[model samples]
Target: MLRKHLLYLTSDHLFAYLWQAGSLTPGPVFGADAAGLRAFALWLADGDTAPACLLADLVEEEFQRQLMPHVGGHAGRQMRRRRLHQLYRDTPYRHASVQGRASGGRRDDRVLFCALTSPAIVNPWVAAIERQGVPLEGIYSASLLSGALIRKLALAQPHLLLVTQQAGGLRESYFEAGQLKFSRLLQTAGHDGMAAGIAGETERTRQFLASIRLLERGDLLHTVILAPAAELDALRPL
Candidate 1:
């Protein structure tokens, strides 16, 4: 059985974990600094050749939804690439994916463009992996993963709001018909005002969605909160 490693990255730290025998062993947590990067490089050099999957839960991420004329084959790929570059020219972590076609008119393709805007937060860790010749499976965003979570949990709502608490903050990702439309992270202070914070943030998100017209007339927003049982207890009344 091949060994696998997982990396969870946030603004302040990068958590490393080793997966063996269906169990995950916690490894070192590296600070996002020069000295930490050096230590991470040394740690990777300890003869572990396992491939890694990096999951980033950073605040500095962007998402844009655009409609473009449907073009298939190689041209479509080039067009999406160019559009991604145009949307986020300065970031190398940009990606675009087609989320089906539009309803009417030209029936254009709906493309979601996203990027990890902070290179300083990610580049060093990625560079360290490259230097060590470790196979990087992929760099994934937590917001993007919420779409899959909704699907896995069988939340089949037309407009869904998925809220998850993470080390960095509270992540609220809005999805339309199972497609991720946008996401935002709020830096929460301790567990003091947890329920209130979630309520306030969730309302704010709804207003923002309406302002942007993501919510249509009489559209119901099904909210799914992913948290521990204790947190859920606190949120149940809200």
Candidate 2:
């Protein structure tokens, strides 16, 4: 085992993390207010004892600078930036802490940011990076990433796997087993955007489950929704 562990971090009212190679609870969710981001950055960067200035630059300049201004708000944008700044000041941009140690030995860590803005809001940031000749691994829809976690944990071993996605033009379910697999993307538009969206989506899920059940003549139930928290919670996979 090469031991690849994924660090999935979402920026929410509190940030949540899941470090998975193997473990239940996946990983515990942790809170990261303005002060916490620096500590987190240090952890992500591993302990290198770089000056606070350098670390802040790494975050603001490298990670958040582009995402900040485009957020567009006379009132909130400055405050968001200021809070992010304060996080930088609180400590070095990152540290390494896995077993409750202040820091040490974080040679391998991938820091993923769960951006709040939509692609339309954040995609332009990439242009600036490209202008500076910075390379990127790739970009993915946040909804897609969310859906992946469920499939990885629950469906990886199943003979037939299905997953649900609920974003504009991103509604879908997938199937796979052995070397066989294909994706089914559904352009399911609900009468009420995403609020009453679930009603229509749930109905579609029911049809999918019913059809699969009939085809297999056995329980082949499968589905996962990667939508807003409220929407995902309200939805019951059919």
Local accuracy by lDDT, each model: 0.89, 0.35
Best by lDDT: 1
Best prediction by TM-score: 1
RMSD of each: 1.5, 18.9
Candidate 2 residue-wise lDDT, 85-167, digit = tens = 45444322222111111123543222212223222223233343344343333444333343355556555534333444432
Q: Write the per-residue lDDT of candidate 1 for residues 5-60, one digit (tens) a residue.
A: 88999998899999778788899999888898998999999958899989999999
Off by over 4 Å in 1: 21-23, 190-193
Error of 1 at 238 (Å): 0.9
User: Can you give the TM-score per candidate against the true fold?
Assistant: 0.95, 0.30
- Look at candidate 1 and tell me the lDDT of residue 111: 92
- State candidate 2's TM-score: 0.30
Evaluate residue 68 in candidate 2 and report its C-alpha lDDT on the 0 to 100 scale.
28
Candidate 1 minimal-lDDT segment of 10 residues: 187-196
Model 2 weakest 10-residue run by lDDT: 53-62
